[model samples]
Target: MSKISDVILRGVTGAFITNSGVGKIGMPAEHSAGLQQAAASGIPLMAKLPSDKFGTFIGYSEVGIGAALLAPFVPNKIAGAALTAFTGGLLSMYFRNPENTQADGIRPTQEGMPLAKDFFMLAIGLALMTQNEK
Candidate 1:
């Protein structure tokens, strides 16, 4: 990869993931309500886990992914795969719950927009993964 491309990928994607991971780890309470609500909406399995624990798990995973990507020694493909799986779970929650979206069902409602943004994460992850195949 060109130096500029390397910097853009590592800098932009790494920073984004790192910030996300920090936010998740630092603010479990803020996300608890939405987590519980999603469980209530369709993902009954989520309901079985304590909200705080679930949040912590998510936080740890994000932190790990962020760290993996930011660490120079770690392979981009591994980080990309982890990010893809994480975002896939998020998208699954959004798609599984109709109430989370607007009348059109594809567009997210006010509550769903946060979840909707995972599309970008998915795209970023896929891009990183594909780049590594060359």
Candidate 2:
């Protein structure tokens, strides 16, 4: 059985991620292009994909991860692993972009605050994965 905290965490994160994914699935061409360009800085392979395709792919991936998190039947470890991997990619993108960081290279610039906040999600994912079942 999952704790109330776990349920709340999963519900909130799942809904947020799912909505973001849905939005991306129908993203404007310019939006997709910009996102692809930014992602390419960290994952060079992303540059090879067409902007529309990239957007759809990312959307579907997020939806799947969100569904996993939302499903009570899904194991916490499995859902956490997915979230961790996704957030890791996001963090990588944030760190790889010089424009997103400050002079210290570790802190976020004004533009990077949104991405930097993903660190909290990463921490939550780690906690979910490591927590023992009650």
Best candidate (score: TM-score): 2
lDDT of 2 by residue, 1-134 (tens): 26998898788888888988988896888889998998888889889998877788889989999999999998889989999999998999999988899999999999999999999889878988998875
- List the global CA lDDT of all models: 0.72, 0.88
Model 1 reaches what TM-score against the true structure? 0.74
Candidate 2 local Cα displacement, residue 80, angstroms: 0.3
Query: How well does each candidate superpose onto the true structure, as a TM-score?
Result: 0.74, 0.93
The list of candidate 2 runs beyond 4 A from truth reads none
Residues 35-129 of candidate 1: C-alpha lDDT, one tens digit per residue: 56664455566677667666665667777787776776666677678779877878888888887788887899888988899898798778777
Best by the lDDT measure:
2
